[model samples]
Target: MSSAPKNEIFTQVVLEVFKVGGLLNIDGDKLTKEFGLTASRWKILGAIMLSDNPVTVPEIGRYMGQSRQAVQRLVDVMAKDGLLTMTENPNHKRAKYIQMTTKAVDIYKQLDMKQVKWAEGLSSDLSTSEMESALKVLKHIAKQISA
Candidate 1:
């Protein structure tokens, strides 16, 4: 017996998703370039800011679908640069709580505003319902893959 033909349409859509991810990274780098931030740094910083409290490097890795070692390397460098601070975690002796410094908060706020405006401009020609549907579909796909 032979397997059925592959889903060409789904494959094409998946490829588009990959392409869009690359474009988003490029645009993110451009937005953060003036703030002395790269796409990687901005993502990690944004993760901490969005958490609204201290989190561990492992937590950030899980949230971003990255490796804990990769997050640790970035966190260590950021801490040295004074953008991140480490506090003792009562629950885990080895896992320190990570938080953004005041300076990093200021930069994050500025970038957040820029990101809002950029998103607005990009979605201006699109319908809100369409955007919502697209977001739902993309998130569903992500959830499926991660599961």
Candidate 2:
């Protein structure tokens, strides 16, 4: 691609990312509204669940590109809701390690099933190779943009 077209495509990609992000949030809200959860909360659950070991609010915040205070606030609420539990962080006095409660694990599993089916339907028309290529490009762009 020439410089001109490349720049245009990049700009379009960024705009599309924003558009798709909003739509995803809307769909997520609709999907989890019955459980009184939002997309951001769902994301935190996902991050903690996907971690190899228990994670801290700060770590989850960084993973999700959010603020520690925000993650902590959400964690507090989740804990009260029985969706998560916090234990003392051996490595840090203040930063507690967060883990999902059994309730959260069950919900996460259900959500994962729904997400897989939703994603499959959304990507039905797209080829695997093309989707993978787009993912590669998006990752590259995100890295560059974050840096």
Candidate 3:
């Protein structure tokens, strides 16, 4: 067989990154399940919590890089579960703004605590400076890939 191309190394790196991301997600999902939340629903709750203003479903979809319908479904389920509330959007008659409920807010706080512990365990050996540098490099790579 012919020798592998130089670009194959980059491809292999990307694949490994995705593989690790998937593993992280699986662990996250297990944690979320303990709170009676799915991975996607927890992600929506997180987005809402991080936003200072009410976020539209479409805006959430765009931020999460998911389809609008998929985000809407998550919103609907959360609303039904009393985890979120939907308000009419004045800017868009058809669109609704989503906000987390008090229950969700409380749960999010618990999740945050768990996440802190998880981070501590995962980076037990890494210094803050190392973590910062890693974050910077990942951010740069994300920007380049998105661009």
Question: lDDT score of model 1?
Answer: 0.91
Ranking of all candidate structures by their lDDT, best first = 1, 2, 3
**Residue 105 error, candidate 3, Å:** 0.8
Candidate models: Cα lDDT each: 0.91, 0.90, 0.86
Model 2's alpha-carbon lDDT is 0.90
- Ten residues in sequence with the least summed lDDT for candidate 3: 1-10
Q: Number of the top candidate by TM-score?
A: 2
For model 2, how does the per-residue alpha-carbon lDDT over 12-115 read when each residue is reduced to its tens digit? 88999999999999999877787778998999999998889889998999899899999999999999999999899889999989999888889888888889
Give the per-residue lDDT digits (tens) of candidate 1, residues 1-147: 435455766687799998998999999999999998888899999889889667999999988889999999999998998999999999999999999999999999999999999999999999999999999988998899989
* All models, RMSD in angstroms: 3.7, 1.7, 3.4
TM-score of 3: 0.85
Give each model a TM-score.
0.91, 0.92, 0.85
TM-score of 2: 0.92
Sort order, TM-score high to low:
2, 1, 3
lDDT of 3: 0.86
